[model samples]
Structures are given as structure tokens and as C-alpha cells.
Target: MPREAAPSDPQDLAILVIDEDEIRASIIEEGLREAGHQRVAVLADMRNLLARIEALAPDVIVIDLANPNRDLVEHLSHVSRAVSRPVAMFVDQSDAGVMEAAISAGVSAYVVDGLRKDRVKAILDMAVARFQAYSHLREELESTRRALEDRKLIDRAKAILMKLRGLGEEEAYHLMRRTAMRENRRMGEIARSIVSTANLITGDEE
Candidate 1:
């Protein structure tokens, strides 16, 4: 999902922290306040995380895992998947490697969609930077799955042009662009239609 624009006031930013340790929570709250965020709340019980999140609609959330709570994972998954909300857990279900390590290491965060990367970077840096050397490396993998799917669609569209009109690759690409402009449709939509027509032809051939 696309991220929306940031709100006008950064000082009005709200944050929530869920941690069993009161001292740690206070430190995080102070750090956030010093960074110019005004509204900060901390919950010691994991059980209240979801309710607070829904009611307050905070800009960022930090969860410290003194005691393991699988419920937090379940809640993040729901928010990310169902409502198209941005939640930060290392195990982004959409990103498999991140998701796996996120699950194992037990740090979870959620950000409202379109929070500036600088803000997130600040929070993560404060939280993760001082960790002991032994716990430092998380799954350093990124997936190109979305890019791969886009390329496959584009290739399928090119094949359709080749088979139907005997056009070369460059010609086919130009034809797709021309059609997209004429119809006022996105290039991806045109590519998808081409792929669908190609599938029909292949089915007939088989």
C-alpha cells in the first residue's frame, strides 16, 4: 500500500511504549520527548497494547520484550494485513526474512503509515544501537518479489505483442506505452490485460 503524506505538526506526534520494565519505559518516553514528540504513554502489561493503540492512534509504538507475548505478533499481523496500516515488526509477513528474524529476536514496533524515515531511524537507532554485540545481526535480507512480479507481467505483455503482430521487443514496448496513453490506463493495467489475452491464446493452443 502507498504511504500517505505526513501530518503538519511534528510536535503533536504521539507515541506508545509497551514494556514490563518501568525504568526502561521511562527512558524511552524521555528520549521521545527530548526528540520533540509531546504525547507519550507507556503500558507495562502487554494485554493493554491493542486497546491503547486503537484508542490513541499513536504515530509510533515501541514494544520491549521482557516477557514473551505472541499476542502482540498476532495483533500486528492483523493491523498490517486487514487495515493496510503500517506496523513495524521485523517479521513483515510481506518480507519473509524480516519476519523470521523479527519473530526470533522479539522486538516489535508499529508506525502510522507515512511516518518520516528519519523519525523511525531515530527511534530504532536509540533502541537497537546499544545492544550487545552478540544480539546485533538480524536477517539482513531484502526481497525483490514485487519487482519480479512486475517484470513477469511486462514480459508476458511483450510476448503477446510478438505473437499477435510479429512486433519486435522495442516496438512492443512502444505499443504498450501508446495504448496506455490513449486509454488513460496505467501501464500495469495494460500489461495485465495483455497477459490475460496471452493466457487465453495459450489455453486454446493446449
Candidate 2:
């Protein structure tokens, strides 16, 4: 699955606290307020979770689950994947397998027995930082993949020009470069157009 990048504001970070227990939710809310976070929302149950999250559009999501079942954890993981927000999950206890699975599903920060009023701010900060880092890495990876694909396209286009026009490799490359410069387009774009045209003419789908 692809990761989404969301905007954040340190001064006024909108936070959503998900906890069934009213007392725990208040504690978390109090801590956030004490830390100067004014925009905060608390969800008591998992009903209409996605719709509420979409409506609120919080910058950070702090979920405090007491003895969460497998289905609940999986559902939260799915929500984390669907939403482009930083998720900090606090559980009373964590299992090794479940933790690994949740992390793989894109939960930003998972805490075991780490739900304290004083630590809420710090954990939220850490979750946002981790989410940003992961999004950056994903962008870099996608860029690299696109670059490699473009390189291959250029190579294929050059080979096609050389074969059809009986031109040398340097001549083919220079011709493509000249056309690219004239059209004010990128070399990769020019190369892709050339390859597409060749494929169309020759009926070579590959």
C-alpha cells in the first residue's frame, strides 16, 4: 500500500484521542491541553470511526486501547493505512506478533503500557516525526523506481532508433536530446514518447 503525506502544525496540532474509557480519555485530553494543544477531539467508541476521522481531519491520532482484540487491532491498522495521519497507539499490553503486524500496516508509533498523562505530548510528537520520516523514505523509493524505469525506456528508445534508422548509439541519443531541447521537455519524457510512437508503429506491445 502507498503512504500519504499530511500537513502538521506544531503550535496548533489537531489531535484525536480514541478511548472507550472516559477517565483515560480525559487524562489524555488534559495532558494535551496542558501542553497547549487547543484543537482536540475524543472518540468514545469505534463506531463510525472512519467517518469521524474524515470529518475531524486531525493531524495526530492517539488511540488508547485496553485489551484490544485481534479484530480491533486489525481494524485500527486498516484505518492507519487508509488515513494519511500520524497514529500513536497505546495498549495496556503488547504482543510481539501483533506489534509487528501493526507496524507493518503503517501504525506510526506503538506503545505498550505507555499511557500516561505526562507522556502524551511527547508520544504524539514522536508519532508525527516517525510518520514524516516514513513518508519521505517512501517518496525517495518511488523516485528511484521511476528513474530506473525511465532509464530503461531511454535505452529501449535508443535501440529502436538505432535499428530502424541505422544510426549509431551516440547519434540516436543526440537526436533525442536535440528534439527534447527543441520541445522544452525532459529527456525522459522525450524518450518515453519515442518509445510509445515506435511501439504504436511496429505493433510491439512490449
TM-scores, all candidates, are 0.46, 0.46
Model 1, range 1-206, lDDT digits (tens) per residue?
Answer: 12235556666667777777666677667777887877787877666666556666667777755556535644664645654455654323454654344435444566776667655656645544322222432222122554566678888889889878999999999999999999998677789888887778678431
Q: In candidate 1, which residue pairs get closer than 3 Å at backbone N, Cα or C atoms, i.e. clash?
A: 90-98, 91-99
Estimate the overall C-alpha local distance difference test score of candidate 2: 0.63
For model 1, the local distance difference test gives 0.64
Clashing pairs in 2: none
Task: Give the alpha carbon lDDT tens digit for every residue of 1-206 in model 2.
Answer: 12234324443656677767565566667767877777778888777676676677665566542425324543544555665443345432433553453354343333222234334437555433444455576789999998999899889999999999999999999999999999999888999998999989989896
Local accuracy by lDDT, each model: 0.64, 0.63
